[model samples]
Target: MSENVRAKAQETLALVDEVNAMVLSDPKAADAVTPLSQADANLGEEIRSRMDEIDMTDTQSIISFGSGAQTELQEISQAMLADVRNKDVGPAGDSLRSIVSTIRGFSVSELDVRRDRSWWEKLLGRAAPFAKFTAQYEKVQLQIDRVTEDLQKHEYTLLKDIKSLDLLYEKTLDFYDELALYIAAGTEKIKGLDEADIPAKEAEIAAAAEQDQVMKAQELRDLRAARDDLERRVHDLKLTRQVTMQSLPSIRLVQENDKSLVTKINSTLVNTVPLWETQLAQAVTIQRSAEAASAVREANDLTNELLTSNAKNLRDSNKVIRQEMERGVFDIEAVKQANADLIGTINESLQIADEGKAKRAKAEEELQKMEKDLRDTLASAKSRRDGVGDTSGTSVPKA
Candidate 1:
């Protein structure tokens, strides 16, 4: 199957398993009586005998087992009916009717005999051996049916558990893989601090300043700018380190919690499913025995106990998973918050630098304008002086 489909199936299975566990754990179903204990031993023996005749591996053969047992019960009832008809069976008919009623009570399906009848019909119903025997036979038939249903339900649950376990295991592996990558990335980013070379740059700038060599004014300005840039880079790196340090604890804590959750899931996957299978098999065997009411009660009690225990385990496991998930969410938010703060700081610093650049540009523009005005004024004065000298010369020549 494709990964997505398989994952969806696993998720569905887990959800179903959890819901079933919750339903089974509820105390309300504890009182529902199981009739296997009150069932007749003859009924069980007859059912088993019919089962032996069929090839259980074959669907038709298994189905025949039920039909064959029902037929046999019918024949027994018919013979008793013939006896009742031929001669007066006295209290025997009443006794048979009581047995049939009891069996009817045990039936999962509502038999026709279960409906309300007139007072006369109710009185006559006891006198009919056929009716009583029919009810009794159907009751036994239904027992096998109940057993079959229970078996199927248990088998389906086991399959779902297996699927859920497989999915959890795969997820655990994936989680660790992703966690490793996360850690690696974090480590790499922290190592970026080393690449900043703050100390080396500081030493280089100091050595240049100490040298007696005459440097141009532009060169001096460039060196000072480089120093300022390096200082800003160092400050930013320090902030990054602080954020990383703060987040590391949460990251490690979350990872540890996740690991613990995975371990618990693994433990359940390994142990719980097989345990359920074993218990279900035992319950099925008890159901087939058709012993006294006590046996049925015992079987039900055991089933309930198994269900309750598994449900509790699953609840505990689910709790851990939930806590881990919550912790993960908290950690993510924490990291986001830290990054946001760092981003805000960087934005503020950039804004300040941008303001400084704008101010410097404005000052440079004003200086250039002042220089142009001075040049214009000097030219205008020189032009006026030359005009005066020309005028004086012309006046002297006319005189």
Candidate 2:
């Protein structure tokens, strides 16, 4: 394969390896979950591990596809390079044309001078053999050209396949990243649920009960109950207001003004006991109304606090989700890039294959040259030095 193709393939493989490493994300690796509780942290770790596993699986698949495409491309590039080199195409044509031109030019220039030479010499002087060889090479060159052209076309198709593989790699990487972020976010949410805010609310409820104002309101309940009972009892008595007013001191003074009638009037007062019952009922009604108003006010104040606290909790949780999204920490894009990079790395093997060819060829060439030189040296050395085996020959008796 050409060097460029080999280099690209190598780059792809390296990238794939890098992507795989990222995807592998060491099973033992751990990272912190910020602002998370212990439970959330544990959950996050587990999720991260799972994400890594998924990433590995996904990256492996992407690598496989990419590698396959790369392999094909490398093969194509190699075939093209091989065809270009091995096929006696353009270079052969150039060499043959040069020979034919040289022969024709020489024949034209030496035509008169060749008349004196023998027929055989003149025949040989025209370079007929060179012309024949050039014709033969030109014929073979056509086949080489056809092969090289086909190989070039195949290389073009390989480039398209590589591009497709690259695109696939990028998409997979994006998906991987998205999945990771989503899982991370979900884990966090689960952690939130596990670390439920209800406990705090329960604590608040407990604390609310202990507040002095709340306790005071609770104390007033018994007083209100007592007042209600008293009102009920007073209503059953059915005392008249007019008779109740007669029990007052001002009314009693008028009755006492008749001193001669005072003993009978005083005796009449015993029948006026229902009038005092009426006055007691009025007093109870006024006091109960005041107490009820105070209780209602206290209840409303406490209820408002409960509503406010509950609203705050909902708002806070919503804010957490929003903040997390805004932070971009759980972004899917990173995963996608990683996946794509991994896919590209997979294709690198193809590049490696392409690269290995040139090195192999060069090494083979060097080996052949060394062998030829060694043969020549051996032939020279044998003439000078006797074919002496090593000075010391080990001969061990059978044990």
TM-score of each: 0.22, 0.21
Model 2 stretches with alpha carbons more than 4 Å out: 1-128, 197-399
Clashing pairs in 1: 37-292, 37-293
Alpha-carbon local distance difference test for all models: 0.44, 0.42
lDDT of 1 at 378: 70
Residues 199-287 of candidate 1: C-alpha lDDT, one tens digit per residue? 44444556765453244344445444544443343344334334434443443443344334333333333343334335434443443
Q: List the RMSD of every prediction in angstroms.
A: 60.9, 65.2
Which candidate wins on TM-score? 1
- State which candidate has the highest lDDT: 1
Tell me how candidate 2 scores on lDDT: 0.42
Backbone steric clashes in candidate 1, count = 2
Clashing pairs in 2: 9-351, 13-348, 16-345, 169-340, 173-335, 173-336, 173-339, 174-336, 177-335, 244-275
Q: What's the number of clashes in each of the models?
A: 2, 10
In model 1, the runs with Cα more than 4 Å from the true position are 1-215, 291-399
